[model samples]
Target: MASQNILDVVVVGYGPVGQTLSILLGQRGYQVAVYDRWPSLYPLPRAVFHDHEIRRVFHAMGIGQDVESISQPSATYQWFNADWKTLVEIDWSSESISDGPVGYLFNQPSLEALLDRKAKSLPCVAVHQGWEAIELHERADHCELKLERVTMQDGKVTRSGETQTVKAKYVIGADGANSFVRKSCGMAFEDLGFQEDWLVIDLKPHEGVKLDVPDIGQWCNPERPTTMVPGGPGYRRWEFMRLPHETREDMQRPEKVWELLSPWVDPEQATLVRYALYTFRSLIADNWRKGRVLIAGDAAHQMPPFMGQGMCSGLRDAWNLAWRFDLVLRDVAPPALLDGYTPERRPQVRAVIDASIAMGQVVCTSDPLKAAERDAAYLAGDVPPLPPFPGLTDGLIVRTQNSADGGIAGQLSVHGQVQNHGRTMRYDEAVPTGFQVIGLDVDPQACLSDAALAALDQLGAYTIGVTHDASKVVANRVLYDVSGKYQQFFAQHDAKIVIVRPDYYVFGAARSAAEANDLVGMLIAEIGLDQASAASKSHASAVA
Candidate 1:
């Protein structure tokens, strides 16, 4: 039976992406229903890495500590040649703009379990694990999804002969590469033409047994390119690229598996957890939204695993959509606000896919001659460094005519510790999560007009003042910058005030308080809040 009331959102898929989106929406008090065909969480490893930005997302979900407990911070990701010469080293152990290690490695299933528990604990979230979304219909204001109950029998999904229909104001497809919602909306992928197969194996070391390996790195040996990295807290993972001469069946044989692990550990030293072949690809949906239906995660983009951003990108999608959907559902922003999703996310996703493909190209080379050329280039410093991870490049952000890179807008806002009300905590914890107007050594409230103040209030924005002076710390409006990160950021950008969006991206930075007010005005204009407010009043009058 279908619920008589419409849900605020219905998520199709129960993987980490869907779980993350549901948790974010549910945290904002939305009625969310999640459907997954699988009878239970897939009890194996898949994605094994997440970066600092994703750590912030986990923090927002109130599971930061739990996730940290199950993961290990990564070290430098060193790539080596066939002769064991260092080709390139990417530092992942250093502190990031998000104020933590640049990356962390974890078992995907364990992370999913944590997210699942957090999502289901929310009062407004209903998780239907054994139901599969078979059909979807998007209408003027809502979407209808038909779900069939299924069971896992003999490791396969089988129909259970029960079905139901549910309605929601919006639907999200966090389903993987073969996404039903994306296909239902008649969307297509813009393939980036990168694909390769590899055999991934996970092993749990026997108690008190130790094996020396790279903390996290890739062996770009032309004979058999390999990846060795941490698999959560106590396990380890290794992926070997399938060579042209090796058949998939031959590679999966027990003897072959043993031969591959012989270089690292023997069977007696470690227990094989799981092993499978994966065809990594690079793809991005041409269009991410249709009517009230949208796609995220693997449904929207997929990339090779060389950069370990496959799961991070999806969680980012969830974070981006959560705030936008919150505003639309609350009528704080016009429905057109949803249009910004694709423009803002797709470019960033494409950048990652491109970067991942570039890295994969370097690691997946199997030709000895080409590998030698690549080694020489790296050894001689001819290889170009991977481009820095991209930020939002379009949509709903303030852009100046003279600034080509949006003048610090669309970049991640800096996070640091602050002292508020005689207690110290991370800056995000000091202020409520929403649009933030943070003044460095200035008072944001003193610079805004009454209209601007009213607009910010309507949008639930947090206007805060941060300064090095301890005497200036006020209960809710001002905080003491204990870590000096805010001061350094302001000095670096030469800005006095920074306007951060709900998703933690800087909307814009301003040189003065008046300019900060203008940034707020720009945000209000971009969101079309005035028109939305007018429409609400008109509807109320008609009802009266």
Candidate 2:
């Protein structure tokens, strides 16, 4: 017999990604349970930096200010050479992010602790601590989760000796690299292990050694490109290239570690706080979704630490997937709608993987000549250290033009408007309910009796008539350049109404009143947000 209990989502693995997912889903009114095997978090410095996008999500969750207060902001990046020579130093503090929070650094544990608290504070969220998931049950309409609860001390053990089953509409796996869910789902992970081991050391450099690091540091040491990044005051991190056949067993001795650090350390004054061995693999699950069971974070993709994107990638996964479930829970969409996840996210994850591998090859090079070539590329602006993609770059949503380029009303299209100004631009209001259309050349009388116009206004779409000004003209969309205010900006775009989605994706150019009506219908169906519309209602019946 199936359990009659109800849950919107059961997030497997309550690490950073899972926890963040739970909070977002819970806030959206979904009954979410965040599961993890550990009773509490481990205190250690693992990953240390987060890009501006992470900070933005935290802020959206209402903890952005608190996270900023606790985090050490590093807006500067520096790369070095074999002789500890400086190559490129880019100040990140002044970066322009398209959306979400900017760059910040916190030790892994501290960040986890904060997320743990946030998860607990969520209204409809449950933190299933000490619960180990042993099996998954995905049915046509729901999923059943089987878990084991455990408790143990330094020398004793006490446990429930029982299994708990949770019935949820959907599930997500956020476990680490060796993810049980990924394996259980029968998903294939393309594991390409070129270099597998690392000798990592975590410590704080003395005053004379610490650079006013914006939060990250990359070393181009040819013999061993050892990267040293500050975690917090009196805390830093070092990742050394593992020498041939040098096992962790051989490096257990403090003296042996001292010898490793001697080249860069002043033999008389340096001390090692924590040192251990690590391994890395470039693995991406062939797919992120399988039935009702899904995976995110390291469970989804694993790459080298060259780009500091591992955790950030998983967090983005949680952000993207959680919202889909929210739509399902509200009964506005069918569960199968989640199928779109893999196509949208896999490409971005692969891009991150390729970028990580390419970056690792560049920074971890032992050849002095090749190292110089890499540095020259950076200096000459031949390449970005890490290429920007959708999730990491504020989840970009580019516009799509209709036939003849502009909206049905081809005369008012802003087709080629590109924002090149140094200003960080943003729409004054959040997404409206339905569709938004920006019309630079508008008939003020058009607002009356325009069903599309009324719907756009009700939904908070940006259906505005424009007469551009010389000020702030770059990023803002300009149409029907009557005043010649955005002369340069308009030079690229034609006159037409530009339609922006609630998700900030451009749905289409509103070519005509008739096209505008059809475009709104298209978005309503695309997002599965149409609750009472007859067209969407009829589509639902046809699918059924």
Model 2 per-residue lDDT tens digits across residues 45-100 = 77777876666567556676677666786656777766556666756665343333
TM-scores of all predicted structures: 0.96, 0.76
Model 1 per-residue lDDT tens digits across residues 476-523: 677899888888888888888888888899888888776876787788
RMSD to the true structure for each prediction, in A, is 3.8, 7.4
Clashes of each: 0, 29
Q: Which regions in candidate 1 have their CA more than 4 angstroms from the true location?
A: 401-406, 531-544
Model 1 C-alpha lDDT versus the unseen true structure: 0.87
**Backbone clashes counted, model 2:** 29
